[model samples]
Target: MKRILAVLLVMALLMSCVSLAVAEEKKSLTVWIPQYQFSKAEDAISDQDFWDGVFDKFEEENNCEVKVEIVGWGVYGDTFFTSLLNEDGPDVVYVTDNYDLVKRDLLLGLDPYLTDEQKDNYILWSTAPENAAGEKVIVPMDDGVAIGYVNTDILAEAGYDELPLEWDAFIEAGKIIQEKTGKRAFLQNWGATSGTSALMLAFWPYYFQAGGKMLDENGQISINNEAGLKTVEFLKKLFDEGIFDEDIVTESESVDKFANGEVAYIVADLNKGNTTFTPAGVNWQYVFSLKGDAGFGARTATDSFAVNKKTLERGNDELAVKALVYITSGEVMDAFHSQIFYLPPYTKDASFVKDEALYALTSAHSDAIYVVEEFEAKKSFEDTLLANIQDMFQGNLTPQEVLDETMEYYNTQLKEE
Candidate 1:
């Protein structure tokens, strides 16, 4: 009887240990990414497998399971904000742009989570504060810039072997292309009298080209100068000349035109041609922005990822930071750059890119790629300006009217804020 009782007690202890082990195995993590990253069927499949492998590796090393949930772009921002404010939010979330996140106080400062050496490995601008708080909120995963992709073959057929250097030359070339090919010379986004992403992409290079200041140092809206007016008028002229697509007011229409071989040249993200257009058999070459009278250069927006402060408060801060590091590490960035066909933020070296075509394209235009650091400061005005410019393109408002109205509305909004 004594032996049997001892054996029963030992069995009970063994069962309790097994139960504890099962509970530990159930530990899980959740990560959120935008739907666009997984939009294509191939992208969806590859991303799932890639992330699964990454998570599995982490789990094997740390003894925890991970769950990745992709959220749609339309509702991603709102959903992420709401989730971050919740008690049971995701362990990690992808941030599109760091400046926007910092402005809204939606991101957690990652300084505590990283060692000095670890932080040093990242690009310098990635860690710089866009706000006065000096909080480095985001880690850049993948980055891309707006560039002019000209169909050299079409340009040559239109009677030009080299691209124009000045705005006048560019417009003239556009006319020649249109006259010769009976296709649009340029493609733009002109839909709805409200600035769309496509229009913003085209407008920035011109603004820089014209030597216009979009915002003041103190972050005040300030695009009412002569250069600004000239820039707007030039774009309006392009529209009046029929150099740009008639339906450019809509987002993706211009890109569609370029992809369909209906336009000789289009302002686009480099990835559009490198990945999407090339695979569809559209042969295009990248070029620097056409120089303006002031010889101003090109500028492009930067996208990044940030941590949620609320998530940090939930006791997995270290793990969350580790996950962020893993995502932004050079190895992961190279993979993302190759897969997404975007410029890598950490390294500008062509040797870093694995894709032959992409390497050559990026290398060719490397000297012209300029990072816009004032993006966070000018976010509000830039948003307003883009909408107003779109309206200008649609002829709902004249160039002057758009500029004046945008300035008035922006100043009013700033005062209210």
Candidate 2:
């Protein structure tokens, strides 16, 4: 009986050893990337192939295993924040939402991992910010502008051999196309009903071109002045003349509509056009200029990757940073923007004949807004501005009244926050 009991104990110990050995063979670093990224390919298998082609090399060179988790944009922020409390969270996170995570002290500071030479790789000196603790947490991977797109087929249908360069000509062309083809002629890339996301990029450029300031040296809302009023009036004009759709809300996108030939012209940056219009094999070209009372210009936008602070304590922070540096550096970055359909900010000029005109207008941004990015306060400002603008459109308020409300709401929120 003693011998029988001893044998059973030895058997149990052997089983546990085998399980431990199997787990040891597959330890891996986890990375979370947005689902839509690298999804330009037709199907899931092809998309996976594209990712594997790039990541497999890194895995081999580093001799470390990795697990790539494709996170969806819809629930990415919610899931990431919840999962971050776990010690086994992803080593790197890509952020498209607000930089709230950084301000909240969630992400790892990348300053320690980066070198001056690597910083010089970008054309602009945007790497460093005064808020080194807060703003300098991201490694910028994608940057672009919002500009115009023209369908050659639509232009020809409108009886034009060349695209228009000024706002008046552009609107006139839109009218001709709508009258001739019985289709909507123009659409802004953004939905008008949403918050400041689209308006900031689509309209702010024009405001700046007209020498309108969005904020003052004291950080006061300055768009209520001449520039702000003119912009509001211009938007109203577009609505009144039916040149722009009044019903465009946060859910609408002009690119998808443009691809179906419902729209003759649109406002989309090179990257957005590249991914949507180019892939659909639409007869399109970028006719970027649409000058207002001021001049032609566009606003630049960016998306970036941030490291996880807990990964540093895990002793794999170096590997995580290396992965980030490689992903955003040289060949990867060039290929990313090229395939994704936007020019790198460092590209000397809009010399690429294929998309020259678009870049020519957007590449040299005239009025870049360096507004204070207090996340909660900015959200409050945009919400109030959106409501006031809606009231102005509904005849419940005047542009001046809207502007006054905007300033009051923003200042109050700024102080409260």
Candidate 3:
């Protein structure tokens, strides 16, 4: 009886040791948040500190480590995919457009974790990931509604109190700003595509306002039509008239021009522009739409919290979902909104009235899907558009030549995909 009792005690001790060993293994969830308006790492204290402090509570609650990395927009896309291919944690990525990851089947659909009741508490600027096939793979952290900021102080020089909401009047006003101030009237990102997205930061909104789209019902190339021709012609007119800064051929340069008050008109999302300018004491009136002859439209995108499939595969999906929910919840979102105006969260009712005002202006503009889930088709479509825009701007190709060449490549390549 004594020997049997001793053996039972030994088995219990062994089982307890195995349990402690398993618990000792630590798993970390890494979140990739794009750097805000500031370019230098030293200037990113608000973002880094806030996140670092917030994650401590999450780590405590989940019993897992959390890593928050601030990544630059320039190389984020390439790095995200490489990480995914390696089954890395860029596990919970917060980005401007994560549709590619969803379409590529790399992102785990979040619907199973985030319930409908959770979605009801917030107003979403975009419908849940447009083509997710019921996965709701992305949780929108903020609205990416594009708004045009008019430097009223600069426009006052031209005797306009506000930017005209009518498209033609706005153009006339921009021309006046150009003629009187000798500063460019308006600027768009003509120099570079936003990471992997071709339509993003490009003049595609103007193209969309003129009724342009990348693909048709059958995924056929469709951007070489009449509306597209009109868009290119209008672009050429802007070029000929010096509406665009010929010297500012890159996005950073163009944004710099706006930041330094060298230009009067700037078009970008609210979060991207106001966060910098408002702090600098620059005052501007935001307009959501500049109606064109084809009627007015606006563009919107979501910067969402997207999941990594590997997180779920490793059975840590609960930790990721809960952490994201906690971050987007009331007090946390209020803190986040206080620092940066990325609109509001989808799981909370927010009083970012000032931001909503700018977003409201853009509400009149229809939202279009520039990026689809099919990785190659989406990238190819946008890349062709960007390349042709560059060629047109350089005076190497006419508008028709640009569209024709772009159409050829888009059709040929998309078919192969």
CA lDDT of every candidate: 0.68, 0.64, 0.67
lDDT of 2 by residue, 1-417 (tens): 999999999999998999878667543577777754544456434434455567788888886677778777666666887667678888877765444565467777776677777766654437322133543666655455566778888788888888775666766777788889888887764445546565655566666555675557874456678877777776666656777654643425777888877888776655656667877878887754466666765555545677777887888888988887777666665554554434544422213233555555544543442222334455556667776766665567777787787887666655453
What TM-score would each prediction reach against the true structure? 0.85, 0.76, 0.81
What is residue 107's positional error in candidate 2, in angstroms?
2.7
Q: Candidate 2 — worst ten consecutive residues by lDDT sum?
A: 345-354
Candidate with more favorable, higher lDDT: 1 or 2: 1
lDDT of 1 by residue, 159-231 (tens): 8887786888888888888899888777766553434353356676777778776657875557788778888
Q: lDDT per residue, candidate 3, 1-417, as tens digits?
A: 999999999999999999898777766788878765353436444677778888998888777898998888776767776777785557777755464576677877777776777766545623556334566777666656565777777899888887775555766787888888877788776666442343554455666677766556874557788778887787777777667646435645555667778778776766755566776667777766555555665555656777778887877787877877777776777767766445544455555444666545554343532322233455656777777777787888999998898778766765454
Q: Which stretches of candidate 2 lie above 4 Å from their native place?
A: 1-28, 37-49, 81-88, 124-135, 157-163, 168-181, 189-197, 212-215, 218-222, 245-251, 272-274, 278-281, 334-375, 413-415
Q: What is the lDDT of residue 389 in candidate 3?
A: 74
Q: How well does candidate 2 match the true structure in TM-score terms?
A: 0.76
